[model samples]
Target: MISVPVSLVVVVPMCASLLIAVLGLTKYRCHWHISIVATFVSFIASLALLYNTLQIGRISYWLGGWEPPWGIEYVIDYYSGFVLVAITLVSLLTTVYAATYVKREVGESRDLSFAILNMLMVTGLHGIIVTGDLFNLYIFLEITSIAAYSLIGAGKKKGALVASFNYLILGTIGAIFVLIGVAYLYMITGTLNMADLRAILPVHYDSKVVFAAFAFITVGLAIKFALFPLHTWLLSAHSLAPAVVCSVLAASILKVTAYALIRVMFTVFEAGFTLEVIPATEILLVMSIIAIIVGGILTAAQTNLKRMLACSSLGQMGYIVLGVAIADQMAMTGSILHLLNHSLMKGGLFLIAGAIIHKVRIYDIADMKGVGRKMPLTMAAFTIIGLSMVGVPLTVGFVSKWHIAVGALKAGMWYIIPVIVASSLLTAFYFGRVIRNAYFASEGSDQGSSSKAHDHAHNQHGDRNSESRSEAPPGMVIPILIFAGLCIILGTAAFIPVSIAEKAAIMLLEGT
Candidate 1:
């Protein structure tokens, strides 16, 4: 197996990000081009790594030519390779879309710095996936978290700063928890390499230190991923960020956090310790089920379009956590499948929301009346993504639910089936309102105070909401369409993800 390019994926972006930051000082606006090329190069490297892993099995790269347990290591397996592909590819697409979107939203002066942050964000996320040491994981996790907080606050909205501050507080707390967990593990096992930890942890299977470490790591990851009850920071942070930034935050960071959660539980701790001995599966199951129902219920209560989509993410993420919590092979596969699925669908949804805001400055659901005709392509993309969100037939969302349901059945958790069905119905309730408002409503459909808001908008911005046939710029529309198309393609050719997920599931379950 090859390892040269594996290191390049992280190194290239890390170095380029520094260069981009330095370039940001000059008059030249070359940061965007450099950022896009760096991410695209990283994407190419991921493709090669995926190919190598698929052909020869998992590959490990040593840093400074040192062996594991003493030196840093980077491993590429089916799972990490799969996620790296998603992370890099989506980062590339967002970079392409962000050039114009950022120009229009955040203005031209901030574009260079934005591109630099974007590249660093991508670099940090890739580093999180490739690193194979517990301490290194925490380190990389911090890198991504800091970048996210800065990006979230980069918007012009007043609320953006508050939201970013909230995230900064909570995210730093989560990072500390992770650090403490890693230290506890190190104290007990005397090694930070994940493979070495897996080997050593079993001997201290009953140790309280090991158990405390697990608790710390899981809870920290839950908060970091914005899992329910801990999700207060996400609504404003994600909704207030610039469209491109929000899309990346919604799509990549938490998905990767979920991956890290799965890796720590199943890889570092071992399934025997996590599933059979400590019984974390059932605890996670109950929490996930709660998140599934409450997240959906809360999403339906939002008046703002972006807040609605942000809440829906809370519910959708529950599906992935549920799949992981179930501890059944099919459940694991379904969870992993949903991870990729949610990234595509939700990423597209947020991008569409951005497009809508850019074109019409409408943020409230009540303000979206008759928008379908005005921004047909943007709304069409939005509708396609929303349908997938509701798990409509022939969409990737449906496929995710089907597997999760079957996995629940396989695990004899018959009660969980109704949770899945009921969550879908609730999802339909909220998204259905958006569809009806967009397609079947009159110009006066805003009902009561929406007219007042519109008048205020008119006074402030001179008929920005006037009905028109314009759509988001082609740069923005193309990425939304690409993600929407993947919803159908991945759903129809379900074997591709199912195959990868099943392999990942088996290897994870059987590794020890």
Candidate 2:
């Protein structure tokens, strides 16, 4: 099979950010155009990579003409390939959504800066997915985090600045912890290539230094993954930021951290060391349960729509982690599957919420009473995703829950069964509240059912006058429809895609 170069994937977006940054100095509008074209092209390229990876088993490309163990390499496995595709597609949709969401949330003058930050953010995500070196992972993780901090602050609110700073302080400490872990691994293993490190590390698993590296890596990633008690920074940072920022952060960054953590736990460390020798699975399992319960209860108390969704995401992510902690074949598949499902589900919902805020200026859930009437398309789209979140049949969310349930039974972790059920109900309660307030509640006493009868009477009389009604702008409507359609399409083909995930799981299991 012919080789596909991976540097192009990373370089394209980074170059675009540079061009946008340069154009930003000239005309802000020019920067937006440049950034959009760049990401769109990158998205298309990612699609090509996905197709190629599916056709070919795997793709490995080394940087600067050096071999894998000596130089940086980009390995395209099924899991990372899927991640690349999903990340770019969301970035593409959000770029389109951002044009509308950002214009309303931020000033036109800041558009270039927003575009630049977005390109760099995605570039880092791509790097994280492809890099075969541990140090490269750290570098890309920093890139993604720094860009995220700036993007959060780009909204220019005092809250935005403060939230960004809080994240910066906490995120920097996390990055340092991760670096310390990498250093410890290198001190003993003497190689930074992940594959090489994995092959050599198992022989010394009982060493105190190797165990310390494992501890440091786990704690550091917990900070990034927002694993329960470590998640204080994410809620506010995600809640107060602009819609586009929230969508990207919710959909990708945290998920990627989990992905990296899984990669390290299952691949870099031997199963004999991680699962059998140490109790990583048990610790992850307990913390995941806590994250699910706490996040769900907190979401029920939120009055702001975006903040509620942000909190709800914490819960959903916890479910993904639960699947990973369960450690059965089906459960691992479910966790990976949810990584895809959650990104699209939350991205679509957040965009719609942002649209609601953009058009109606309504943030409180109470104000959305009868607002659905004015925005049928947006509300209807919201209903589809909300039901999916509740694990309704024929949605992606149901597929994930099904797999997780089966995995739980297979492992005979009967105690976790109730926690899973309760968490599902909590999701239902909060999302059901949104639907109840939206479709069931009356608008107001003045705009009551009787006034609706009068309007119906006026309409029946063939009066030439009536209030105007229209859907959201095409930019917003189109992406919502695309994502909603994908929810169904992916759910329908869930088993087929899961084959790839199974292969990935098997590869990690067998340690080759």
Candidate 3:
């Protein structure tokens, strides 16, 4: 296996963002090229790191030659290594898709800023996954949040600015809560290092300060990951933001926040403390159930495609949190697997939404009648990924859902089985509606629907005649197909990721 410093994964993108910012002053037109190259390097580095981690058990790199508990440390165990590869791979694909999507929707004038912020976002997400220090994780979390806010605000949509403002407010509150949690942990343990805190926190587990810290962090991260009721900022931010930005936000950013929560709950505090000490998992389980049902209903209620996908994301997040709350080895494995599965599923869906809008100038689900005939390839990919979201067999979605369901059974929580089934039904209903409109309905069926959608597309792209058949550029279509392919490939080859996730789950359950 190849060897590389874990820090290099974070550094490549960070430095690229700086380079892009500096070059933005010039007439450089290849910002996307730079972004793609940087993300590719980061992805390769992450893959190599994951390979080394699997070989050696754990890989830790100290910053500036300082050891852990004294200076920043980057660690890649099975869990983080798995997540690092998934996020970086998604980042690379999104960058490639954005090459054409951004140029058309956002214009070249703003490409530089978009490219720079995209790299910064990757840097922050990578930092969050690898950091061994609680404070450093918080720092990276804030970095990611800020970049996302800017990216959303940079969108050309009417409510983009307001969406960004709302996310900024909520995200800042979450960050403050996380900071306070870290401060409390440090005050009690005299160390910010996660491993060190894990060793010392057991003694202080009964401390009210520790309980308060866990509460603050859990609530804060719950908000960050958009776990239902707190997911108010996600719909607008996703609906109004640029396509590629939405892709990264839904796919990578949200998953990383969930990862941080997992790290804190299982790694820092241990399963016994999170699951048994205070009824945290019980409370979270209830919240997750509510999120699954409510998010699905909200998704089904949307007329707009982007809004529907955004709402669906809220429900998908529930699946992840549900596994975490289950706290068993199988459930934890499912939770971690869903992190990668949901990223691929949702990321591809958003990209397809962007592609449809880009080609047909339609955002309303009602306006999607006969779109399958126009962009056959794009819509085909969308259908496959949408089915995955519905947890169809032989897709990545079903594999994770199966594991979670069986995990629930293994844990003797049969009630959750019905919740999972109902959520899947809700998912099928909503996605089925779109697929029907796209494939079965007549091409001109949208003629009777509201012209507001047409007016919006007309004003933005100046393309009034959306009846003609068209497809998104190759640059965009290729990435979407790749994501769709992975949904099936990983599903059939389940052991590949399951092998790693199982190990990570065991490590967490054993409190290693």
Instruction: Compare the candidates by TM-score and give the number of the best one.
Output: 3
lDDT of each: 0.86, 0.81, 0.90
TM-score of each: 0.95, 0.93, 0.95
Candidate 2 lDDT over residue span 1-512, tens digit each: 33447776688889989987777677444665666776777777766776777788677788998998999988777777777777778888888888766666788767777888888998898788888888999999999999999999975457988988999999989888989999999999899998899888878888989888888988998898788899899888987888888888988888888888887888788766888888888998988999999999999888889889989988888888899889888888888888888989998988888788877787878666655566778888888899888888889999988888889999998877788788889889888777755654445422322344554544433223222345668988888888888888888888766777777776666665
Error of 3 at 497 (Å): 0.8
Q: Candidate 3: misplaced stretches above 4 Å?
A: 446-469
Ranking by lDDT: 3, 1, 2
TM-score of 3: 0.95
User: Best lDDT goes to which candidate?
Assistant: 3
**Runs off by more than 4 Å, candidate 2:** 1-3, 445-470
- Model 1 gets an lDDT of 0.86
Residue 406 Cα positional deviation in candidate 3, in Å, after optimal superposition: 0.2
Q: Write the per-residue lDDT of candidate 3 for residues 365-427, one digit (tens) a residue.
A: 887876887899999999999899999999999989999999999999999999999999999
| CA lDDT, candidate 2, residue 70 | 97
Identify the superior model by lDDT, candidate 1 or candidate 2. Answer: 1
lDDT winner, 1 or 3: 3
